[model samples]
Target: MISTSPRATSVAGEPDAMSAREVLDLARSQQAAEDAAAARKLEAAARWADLHPPQSRHHAASFTLDGIEHEEAIAGDGCPTVAEFCIAELGTVLGISTTAAKRLIGHALELRHRLPRLWAAVHAGCVPAWRARLVAEATIHATPALTPASVAWIDAQVTPFAAKVGPAQLDRLVAEAIARQHPAEPVDPDDPHPACPDGRHVTIDADQVGFGGTTSVAAQLDLADALDLDHALQTGAAELKALGSTESLGARRAMALGHLARRQLALDLASATRLAADTDLAGQPTSLPAARALEFHLHFSAGLAGGLEIDHLGRMDEGQRLMVLDLVKSWCGDSHTKITVKPVIDLNTELTAPGYQPTGRQREQIALRDRTCVFPWCSQPARRCDLDHTVPFDHHAACDDPAQPGATTTSNLGALCRRHHRLKTHGRWQVSQPASGVFRWTSPHGHTYRRDSTGTTRVDSDPDPPAPPNRSSRAA
Candidate 1:
């Protein structure tokens, strides 16, 4: 029966006569071989996870989901799948979230995408699991966030390893790592280490490459740790640059930095712009700027000399204009000291005319300049921005004669995207444009910085469109 069932395998006309003892020994040997294969696979898995530990605890915490871990924990007695165990280990040992852990294991399953040697090296404990997974991911997907040039560069580098995976996934993995390795703003060129007012130090660097084009990478860092990162990035960058592009070390390091840059931006863009929870105000819905709000201070020479106060106008129906007139009267006093007034808003970043009532052809110039967002870290096109008056046109102090006409002039108007507009108006921020296109902002405490418009040129290429369905982003 066994011979007829196809399980019995023997060369035709050979081994027809065999003892029961021999048959038992052969069966045992086959089982032993199978057990050995399982053991090797188990060892490979152990080697892999031990090396790649995932990213920072915060990243693991934020990106990872929890439900997956709960499921694995319940499957105690029965051994879980390789993926399940990997996810559980990251969560338990590294304290990473289950979602991120699952992502890591998922990358491991697609061996055809990554370099076999890199994979083996990871399993052999030579490379860190986070880095290994980075390599693994680069081998699989073509993430759209990466720029065409970077994608091309990655494509070239991974071609030799194409036997393992296609160009698309390889680019993705490289793009991911390059995105993660650096900060948003290049360390302040002066301090080499600068922090935001909220006490987070900026770590982004402009020179660093990403899946996308070059961008400033920013992050809060431990001063000492930041210094260490600065040295590593700077020094490694120098060495690879010196080695030239053809060298393996140079190419690998460059690709790695590209991955780090993109990942870091993705991380920062999320946290750096968290908004307040309140959405609806009275009957109308209000959306806070994605970033911090900007507040403007209209300083007057003296308290409104003869102006009406907001309290006095409580019964008036025309509150908006009355509010403007009241502010003008107070600041118009002849006292040498300037009187100040401020109007604030949560939704729009730029301080616009109270009722979208822009003065004169101010709107025409704003459209012409289409002045892109002036924030140092951002480059959103002007069509997406709101028109802001350098000097609030409504304030009397801002006018030549409050009675003659509202303050309106081309030079006084600037385009600030919603976020920077909010940041300037609400956050006690000040901007100074020493040159035509360049504008420098002074923080509330008087720290001065500038955003140069040097690299804001249009690109004219139809490279492979960014993946997914978005056509505009592809061209952009």
Candidate 2:
């Protein structure tokens, strides 16, 4: 039986009876049209605002959802870890791209951390819903790695300056301070030619300083030359003089000096000219490398030999001399050295070592094998993807398959970006090396897929349309 209720009426019908099913369908269609119109109106309004200059006319039509305030449970109580879990699930199980999932989780986590104040600013009619997000980022959740304490600190710091300057400026200051306080440790080729056959080393010297830290390459190298190598002894029976009586020379400086000495003695050596030149902060060219390549420090480690206790350049051992000679050879491959600038490191710790001890053949092979990134969706060329161990040597020895040996074997390596490397290590993803050059990806949800060297589809023969969303189906 069909009802003649006004709710079921399509219009002021001049008396035409309709079934309940037809009436409901007509009502739904009308509601959908209304929604579409509203959406269009909102979009048009936004576009109009973009073109026209905002004045009194912009606020001519304003409305609010004024009633009573409502309460909701605060976030951060229920699994702030939820976003990370979701990212892992989406990346691993759903077969969604890890990059897309990572971005989604990043935004969700950011919102969760500061939804309270963000929502309040919007409710007061002071800002738009979109503006709330901008405010959230500018005020509440400024950085991706903001802790509760950091947020509180930021709020306290910004309240005093919000009127004079702006939150963006404050963000820059905070970022700078954070960087100054905790800079990254340089890691790469300590001795790119560990087995150079010829006993040659490159000695780098200079001073390095950050916000409040300094490394004296010259002073530290002096300490290493004063140690007993055969018995790992510091033969200072006399006053047992400490490396540095001055407050300036810290443990880091000592370590720098020690490492520098060792670098000099190694069969291969080179200054991190490329790395130094790349990070050129304006106004402070000396901090990186625009002036001298690296400032030679007096102190540094001497590999197996003890630390250089004092400045003694002439007393360098046969190994150290060989290292210096090689540096000269590398610098002046033809005849006279063309390099005008000497290396300098005011702070020893600031020095960076050269990259891996790659044989020319090994490099050539790597270039050929990895033409580009190996990640499924990543189209980044070979230049971008870093060569990484397919089966990380860090994983337990028991886990490594005995069938595959050699560290330099092509079968043991693949290319991945820095982000994907983090995903594999920290996130819930697994890469299987069942066969040589055949990479299989199983989503967290157990959906298996494969990609070959050509980065082309290697799907089994299946002549059919795309399968519905279910495990028992195959992708078209």
TM-score of each: 0.24, 0.30
Compute the lDDT of residue 202 as modeled in candidate 1. 65
Candidate number with greatest TM-score? 2
In the range 77-149, model 2's lDDT, one tens digit per residue, is 2213332223433443323465544443333333335344433333343324343333334432333344555
Model 1 agreement with the true structure over 1-476: per-residue lDDT tens digits = 35764245567845556567888999988866654553344345445554544334453455654323222221111222342333433332333333454554455543322244544544454443445455545534433233434434443454344335544665565665445432255566678547644556666553233322223556777789879866666655665556563546554445446534434311223333444443466644353223322122222222345884334331111111122435434435312223334332121123234332564344533533333465544545555677776655554344345442334444446678765565566545676544333455554444444444332211123222222221110000
TM-score of 2: 0.30
Off by over 4 Å in 1: 1-356, 393-406, 434-438, 443-447, 452-476
After superposition on all CA atoms, what RMSD does each candidate show versus the true structure?
A: 29.4, 26.5
- lDDT (Cα atoms) of all candidates against the true structure: 0.43, 0.39
Query: Which regions of candidate 2 deviate over 4 angstroms?
Result: 1-100, 116-360, 367-372, 378-386, 391-407, 422-428, 433-438, 451-476
